[model samples]
Target: MKRALLALTIVATLATPAYAVLPDEIMADPAKEARARDLSRELRCMVCQNQSIDDSEAPLARDLRLLVRERIAAGDTDAQVIDFLVARYGEFVLLKPRLNSHTWLLWFLTPLAFSVGGIALWRQARRRARTSTERDEALSNLTPDEEARINQLIATEPVSEK
Candidate 1:
């Protein structure tokens, strides 16, 4: 029925891969195709900005995918393909940036900030705990007469404002 067809369509859509690699773009040699696919995952799609070339449907992504395959076909090593892309597009072409003088700050900043925030939270919690225990200790140290006076004060009715 219509409901069964709809359920099947949903299942089929979910089963399909999100990648944009076309059958025509795939290399004939299995080894070269594997290499191309691996490299495609590392390269960024220039037009899509946030997506890897392998995952992007942009025209520029297709061109870059083809270029990677062409490089592999021409006997370029994986390192050579990466180097060529880096040289042509700068470090921004890579999905994960390389660690260098320019990127050292970017790599180290997140962990440093997380450590600082964690330490700050720990100190704050300790301070609150100490203050609360000090308050309880003060209450415990109160004389029986003082405690009676406090209870009396609480039990007394407030004076009416005229």
Candidate 2:
């Protein structure tokens, strides 16, 4: 039983790299099939937003795989196929959106947010440090009369054992 389980585990591990491509969707031409696969890997599955069409098992992924193969069979260049998809679905179809004026904000927003947060934190630290220093200085610069009064009060006060 243990040996059977171990064999099953090995088989599953070996088969895990199998893609979501169906037999019917595969192109007869090896070159076109390979190109379709490369393009599929670059395309995003709308249903599984984080997974590429090549890896996603979603119905949308399967459709995209078939679409890519169909384009390849139609003699479309890789770039042309990508352009067609991008035109039809917008840049969101690509796993990585192209850098453009429209997307500049999306790409740069993170660093900009970090920079603003850092500046705010730095200003806060400076303000706190200044306030702390001012408080300490005020406490240390007491008048001689004040020190004398405090000493007198301490002398009169009864000491308690903790």
Candidate 3:
């Protein structure tokens, strides 16, 4: 039992890396780590939608992670670091894309489309209602003589036995 327990503990410890990012990857200062973590959270994971680069294991995510750490260690302010990345990569690099002329239509299009569709449906229903004759006024357009002839034809029809 003691041997089996020791083996289990060793395997579990070996399964996980001592540090996901190597000591070489980290900046010497702890202050930079906080900012690096913040920037990482803001970055999108290209390989995994909805995940931040910090949480992703993809190579691209790792590269981005490294880049952020490098920038932070190089004495770049948080905003400057972010702007640098944005300059290198377009707005698509942002996990939450900013609202702009290029994306305004994309953001508002669904509601606009729904409103237009609703209007079209309402118009179609109004047109159909206007064009159709109600059963109560089936002969409203007919003269008295025409009405009499239709009634006579109905009266002359033979009845069928059920």
lDDT of each: 0.95, 0.91, 0.82
The TM-scores of all predictions, comma-separated, are 0.88, 0.73, 0.55
Output the better candidate (1/2) by lDDT: 1
- Looking at model 3, report the run of 10 residues with the lowest lDDT sum: 17-26
Clashing pairs in 3: none
Q: Write the per-residue lDDT of candidate 1 for residues 28-123, one digit (tens) a residue.
A: 999889999999999999999999999999999999999999999999999999999999999999999999998998899999999999999999
| Model 2 worst lDDT window (10 residues) | 18-27
- Deviating ranges (above 4 Å) for candidate 3: 1-35, 75-77, 128-162
Question: Model 1 scores what on Cα lDDT?
Answer: 0.95
- Extract clashing residue pairs from model 1: none
Indicate which candidate wins on lDDT. Answer: 1
Q: Give the winner by TM-score.
A: 1
